[model samples]
Target: MVADDSKMWRTILKDLLSSEGYDVITAEDGLQAYFKIYESCVDVLISDVIMPGLNGYQLCRILKKDPHLKDMPVILLTGSADSVDRFWSMYSGADAYIEKTSSNALDNVKKILKNFKWKSDMPPQDGKNVFGAVLDELLAETTLRAEISELSNHVEDVDYTIQKIRNLLRSLFGIKAFAALMITMSEMILYSSLKDMKKTEEDLLSRLKRPYFPSYHTYRTIDGKEDVEGLNSIYKVISYDGKEEGVLALWRERSFSVREEKLLSIICEEIGGIFKNIIEVNEYRKNAYLDDLTGIANFRAIEGHLEKLWNSGKNFEISIIDIDHFKKVNDSYGHEVGNEVLAGLGKMLREFGEKHDVFVGRFGGEEFMAISEKSNFLTSVMNEFRQMVEKAHFSQSMPTLSISVSAGVARRDDFSSYTEVIEFADGLLYQAKKEGRNKVISYESIG
Candidate 1:
């Protein structure tokens, strides 16, 4: 029996298995498949994990508990790459778990079927003993537990992090709103519940910014403002690596009891590590796509951006800019000064890209690239940037020093592929250098 929600997968699997000399029966969903399995003399069942009415796990669990069908081979298949699905399939007593996305899916299914010894003596069982209400409740509880367990492993999105934390706390305190203030080495970030609390935020920031003992505290205050007067608050200073770095605060109209305060303290004790992990993960992700020295998008990021635009069939232009006589600058001055020059140029190009509605990145050492939707004045835009680099001072110590850039611009129509466009632009850049340094070369200029 082949059970899948997608008609294409159902047709394909049925045709393949039928060609392999096994009689194939198809159902659009797990519920229909469950009824059909009881009526037909099925040797093995192949079920897709995600289906309407009943999922693969739910169906497998029901079959495994029945006296007659307990020995039947059940193969669970899914297109999902998440590891949690494998765990769930095993927990639900599936005979074998297979990913539909795998190249050897049919081979794996055939292998499992070949090794199975069918218990032909036991007849098919009826659905009279199956309790739908009990099964539904069990599945609901199991799913909720799985989602809560997954929270610790998944922390890629900021909004998801906050929402999950809120959900975790909602049962404990009937949580309405909360706020967090994180202080990293580079910047400070603040998050608050969607409820309007501008005045409350101001008060908390002013009061909590000072140094505090690394512990949770509860306070009841009667400030002049009516909103502030009736509230009770609890806040904890989160410390890691022997230094205070952040704070988490919650407040409500009713005063917090002693038991709730202790629970809050226990929960707050572990939050420091969570916030630290979030900050470190965010930093690592940011550094992965940005150039270390120049703070611009790196080559890998640039390539991804260009590929995305190209795949979308957008009309755009690519501009390649190279610093003239950059090797001489490194030889005359130390690499430290050369780095300063590169950093300054990167910053200037970033600002220029933002102002001109272009995307710019550091292609490599002494070379930067810009991408923009094709415009009639594309050549003039490149010249404007070239002139900016010519006029800018790279270092305050040597105000009289001059720096210039040579550029090449190519439109999307000039080449068949994005890589070819970049190569053509690079050739124009070489032509500019061959004719004279610090020149803007393009198809328009050469033509």
Candidate 2:
């Protein structure tokens, strides 16, 4: 979700997300945005700090107060550099604060989204929605318990640091107080990382039901404190079923300490548990809908998705791609080599299709399908796939092999069933093979 008063900025942001394959929702102001949030689910919220009818700060406060919406990541974009402005943004519950003039806003947005977790359902609200009320309840009961436990342990070390400072101050110069202050600040930084981790875990658990893996690394500052040069600390929540999920990395100018390490470990463990749950859910979904070998949408998944989209009254193009002389290759290279080629081709198609919003999947042995938003681009994407196959370099030890694919693309302006579009595309693909291998033939051309 993008909320800004400037129509130009809103359009620009929306286009950027669209180009990157995201379905975006836009609002002109904070009030409009609050209504949207109430009505829909948004993965991330990007708001301009200064807006009419509930500014970004007020918006953040409202969201953070709401039990149903507080878990959603809110990023505040400001054009201000004043220390007071930064403090206000933070105090208002903004997860991240960025300058509007900074070229890194987009990067920061990406980072926030990558780490964000959204809740699936919310507890019923009673009276006026208060910020952080439900989250405060949930955290106290679950997430905060884990965090507080970790913090309690750190408190002991902080006490020792205080004692050491007192002794140093009396015996040495009066610099002991400053030294203790610095250590206290470092510990606070560690506490913030841990808190963020717990929130991330809660978000993932609420949003996903799949098994996931969690990994973490802690870095210490140059003075052997809790800062790291490249990373404050890194936490990654990965789906074990092979999908990239959430990654949260905080960067500071220094390194970490023993207390920080313990806190990081606990945070990583909590995050990993949540990820594991998501992965498990994904695995069940995958088993029901994915091809075991190619890892593309299985026939069932593609058919279902296509049906849904078709029924939703959206226009789409479907194409069938067949490997040219694939049987002959299998016979010449044997099944083992043929399987290798199939896997290699599958990977290539996946990577190439990423930039084009094309969904490429194995329809069956030696045959594949690619769906694209633009029917015209289907032919070009297939053409590129064919050229890549023709120029591919196989294993050196095995016999040098070359292969090509023939594709047929079909587009529909009118609503049509999935079967109709697929059949049309398949017919075109057959024509490509019949005319000559390695060519893209379209239904329009054939008709």
Please name the candidate that would achieve the greatest lDDT relative to the true structure: 1
Report the alpha-carbon TM-score of model 2 versus the true structure: 0.46
Q: What is the lDDT of residue 292 in candidate 1?
A: 79
- Cα lDDT tens digits, model 2, 1-447, are 899998887997888778877778999988788767666666678899899987999888877765566777888887788888899999998888988788887777776676766654743333224334434544434553364334433332544433432342223222111111011101111112232434434433333345433321122122122322243333333233444334334343345555444444444444434444433544576578767666667788777778787877777788888888878877887887888777777767777777677877788887888887674677767777788888885544464777788899898665347788888888888888888878889866756
Q: Would you give me the overall lDDT of model 1?
A: 0.76
> RMSD to the native, candidate 1?
18.3
* Candidate 2 wrong stretches, greater than 4 Å: 1-248, 252-265, 394-399
Tens digits of lDDT, candidate 1, 1-447: 999999998998898888888889988988888777777757788999999989999888887765577888899999998999999999999989999999999888888888888844556555433446436645654554554546656556755765676666666676555676655645455566524455544555565546433221222221212333455777777666655557777767777886577556556555666677777776786698889777778999999999999999988888899999999888987788898899889888877887788888999989999988866556788899888888888976667777999989888885779999899889999999998979988867766
| Candidate 2 accuracy as lDDT | 0.63
In terms of lDDT, the poorest run of 10 residues in model 1 is 215-224
lDDT of all predictions, in order shown?
0.76, 0.63
Candidate 1: deviation at residue 274, Å?
3.0
